[model samples]
Target: MPKLMNVRVTTMDAELEFAIQQTTTGKQLFDQVVKTIGLREVWFFGLQYVDSKGDLTWIKLYKKNEPNNCAGQIMQKLFQPNELEIYPTKVMSQDVKKENPLQFKFRAKFYPEDVAEELIQDITLRLFYLQVKNAILSDEIYCPPETSVLLASYAVQARHGDYDKTTHAPGFLSNDRLLPQRVLDQHKMSKDEWESSITTWWNEHKGMPREDAMMEYLKIAQDLEMYGVNYFEIKNKKGTELWLGVDALGVNIYEKDDKLTPKIGFPWSEIRNISFNDKKFIIKPIDKKAPDFVFFAARIKINKRILALCMGNHELYMRRRKPDTIDVQQMKAQAREEKIAKQQQREKLQLEIAARERAERKYQEFEERLKAMTEDLAKREQDLQNAEDKIRALEEQVKLQQQAREELEARQNELQEMMIRLEESKNLEAAERQKLEDEIRAKQEEVKRIQTEIEIKNEHTRRLEMEVEEARQKKEEANRQLLAVSTTPQHHHVEENDHDENDDLPNGDVTKDLEIDSSIVDPVEERRTLAEKNERLQDQLKALKQDLAQSLDETKETAMDKIHRENVRVGRDKYKTLREIRKGNTKRRVDQFENM
Candidate 1:
């Protein structure tokens, strides 16, 4: 059925079996385990397996697992005989005794071992530093005196990139800054002494960068051999507390009371397989000649999951680190002498470098002082230039003000002359106006007299016309009476006789009537003469009135011109005075600016 392989799955608390295809990935198995166990935070979990070299290796989900491909084979493949485990990102170490609880406590010594070994120490050290700092800050762990020294040294290195013997310690590396005041006082190293000591120490690390040195030294202090390790505490039958460290180097068990020394070591080289039940752990060695070793921490009541973890770590170390031969040698006398000579040379060189640094510092101070003086001189020059500019501007302003004053004064003089001329013209116009008024009055009187004479002539002519008409009517009546008398008979004959008689005597009466008729002469001719005179007087009056109007307009124009001239003169005088005042204020401002 689909070429299924029998694979054993192990966890912190239990072990189980699953039938799966060889091609199944770690992710698929991890998911199944999480789903079955109802594990929380599946993302922070992974499956790790031990290889033939006794090194623990993480199974990447993306890559194919070769060992799992074998089915029904007598080989100790990953799934056939061995097991894989689901572990938290930071594996837990359980202390088994008195049924004690499983705690996720990791030791400071195992701090660096958690990071990937392939990563450079520069990067790995940073991780360790942060983890250690957090652990200490949270009071989860404490750093001893020797550990603090290593921390301080590494901290200095991290702050300033790798160490250089030629360069002295930076000012920030002072004991007060790197260490607490109390710590510094306890050490009793003066500033100079502290600096010298750090410098000498920094010079010794010539092989690797500071970060590598820091991590390497930290591992040594913690007494750790490999990365990615888990430590457990267990007790034997006698109730003697013992520690077991499981890493890529198989299982290391402490024999003596001291935790650093290992009494028994299983490198996974002779280990064939592992299995456990509750507090019982068994290791099957590959060498047929050796018997299987069994361990029990019944009093401590070790958890079965911890045994699984131990088996997993043993398999990892067995697979990763292959057994190889190593050659050992001892240092000869010649090598020792050469190393001492190198040390002496390095010390002598440091002395010379210190002397040069002091000289350079003095020169730098002198140069700074020179630069400051030069800057001051430049500032003074700038001030002088500004003052000169102000002076020039004031001078230009004064010249402008003087020129304006001259123009104003000239305008005033011109306006004064114009005023004098306007006054003279005004007087002349007044006299001319008076003369025209007098002439106009005389013409008016003449016109009035002529008008009255024409009116009287018209009346007299009208009366003469009536008298003529009455005389004509009397003549017509007398003719008609004479004709009737002459035609009608005796009376008319009698009158004719009397008329002859009177013709000789009628001389006086007839002459008197003729004279009266001649006396009634037409006055139209006299009236015509008066009318001509009246028209001539009217023309003269019109001409005189026009002249008077012209004279009045001229006087008005002259008066307006005179007023305009006076105003202009006063305005020019005022403008000149204001300009003079403004110039005085400008001069005062210029003086103030100069003083400043």
Candidate 2:
């Protein structure tokens, strides 16, 4: 029976233990882990473990001497290394006890050039995000102060949903180490000031979803100078310490002091070969004129790691240049669909919230209006009570006036006669008002007729102007043709004159001369006719304008006349009212006599 060995694998959020045979290979363990996690894009991830040499290394998943098939040979030639054969083949040592579980970490080993385009699954992006966040907070990845603040803002938004003034108070960020310590030390800002800046940026991502926030964080993080770079300490041929960075694009060499900028770069396309012997690694250039690049690592294991990284990066670079596989295309489409769905869901929720807010505002306005109407109703109720009291007092006055009313009968009869005269005057005023209204209507009809005639005259004038323009163009063309004819040879002109003098000339020549003369004379005559027509149109337009002015003046005069008539009617009404008042005074005096 094969001895059973325990292995513990750690993921981003969880850890799992596997009991396997001691002779199990790394490929078997990796496949089990990926199967357990249900990860489809297996190329981006690998199992990492610390070797006996105390150096972190990727667990090799393939045997050392796999059959060299056609596809394997092709990959080996392109990447210059059989990357599959480089990893540790055996996962467990025979000397390790079954109770002792070896530890391995599931990590994103490869990074894409573009996160938005290459990372498809939510779980994949989340893994990438967590890894990058860990790298940033641990100071493994360096960031500038402003970029650190912005990235912290995205992390805050992703974790806390959104920035709330009450919940995310001043001391809220004291416990959270969102930015790297180096960045904080470099800026020399207070904790509260840094929190304020982060919150300010966080507020800008108000409605961003958590996944979207994470995506944004990754998008920004990928643009940093050290993004996706795996650095190793190495020495050049000159015995100078330098940094070797292997990334998706190519291999880059940096000075020992400065890691932010690269001193020399060799893109994978320009590199012909990469080989390692002991502690020395050699990089052959594609150009024969350029010298080979050589560097020495501190350990052979480091050189092995560098070689593996170079192989993986070069393979990916070549793969990216080709078209995407079917699985990648499908994943991209699915990711797009999911993104659209989430966006639509967010929009729907926002619209619902907006509508609820609008409804709440309308409800508030209605409540205010109802309150004002209630107050008005109370005021009108008080006024109604006062009106009722005045009605009772008027009833008492009516009873007191009943006794003198009969004694004033003769004065009342005389008042009736005055009222008859007033009625006759009112009838005459009504007749005058009707006559004035009729005259105003007739004048308005005349004004409308004048406006219609003006429109017609304007249209006719426009037609005449168009005809005049056409005639002018024809005259200009005729003048141009006559100038051209006169500029021709003098012999041609003399021949034309001789043709005109000779009556015995051919009929065709005579016809041609007549045609030429007609062409010249017709334009002049037509121009004269058009000029006359234009002049007549101008006069007509002017006369119509004058008529329009006259009509407007008449309309204004009619308005003034109406105003004067209204004033006279008002004066007559006032005079009649005065007469009625005088008669009423006389009647009241007679009633006083009767009362005496």
| lDDT of candidate 2 over 1-596, digit per residue (tens) | 87787889999878999998867888889999988887778888998877665667788786455564653222234554444545457776422222368888999988988887778888888889999998888767765445667788889898888777877777888888788776555444678877886887789777779997898899778866677999999886667788888888777766676555564565677777777777888776666665557788998778878888888888888888899999889988988999899988978887677669777786787677557656655555555555555555445544434433443454455555655555565647777757655655565565556556555655655565565555556555555654553353544322244554555555545433232343444232343343574466446445533433332323323332344245445653322422332332323422322232
Best by lDDT: 2
Per-structure clash totals for the candidates: 24, 2
**If scored against the real structure, what TM-score would every candidate get?**
0.32, 0.58
Cα deviation of 261, candidate 1, in Å: 1.4
Q: For candidate 1, write residues 1-596 as lDDT tens digits.
A: 56565555565445656765645655666667667665432333455554334444444444213354333222222225424453332111211111112111111222322233422323334445544444433323323222334444555665564566446435546633443333233343466655554544444443334454555445433432222345566655445566665654456555334333344555545466665544545566565555555555552224444544554555444433454223101222333475477667756676566568777776786577557656655655565555555555555655655565565556556555655555565657777757655654555565555555555655554555555455445545544644443353443221223344444544444211112365654343344343574466346445533433332323323332343235345653222422332332323422322232
Give each model's whole-structure lDDT. Answer: 0.45, 0.68
Best by TM-score: 2
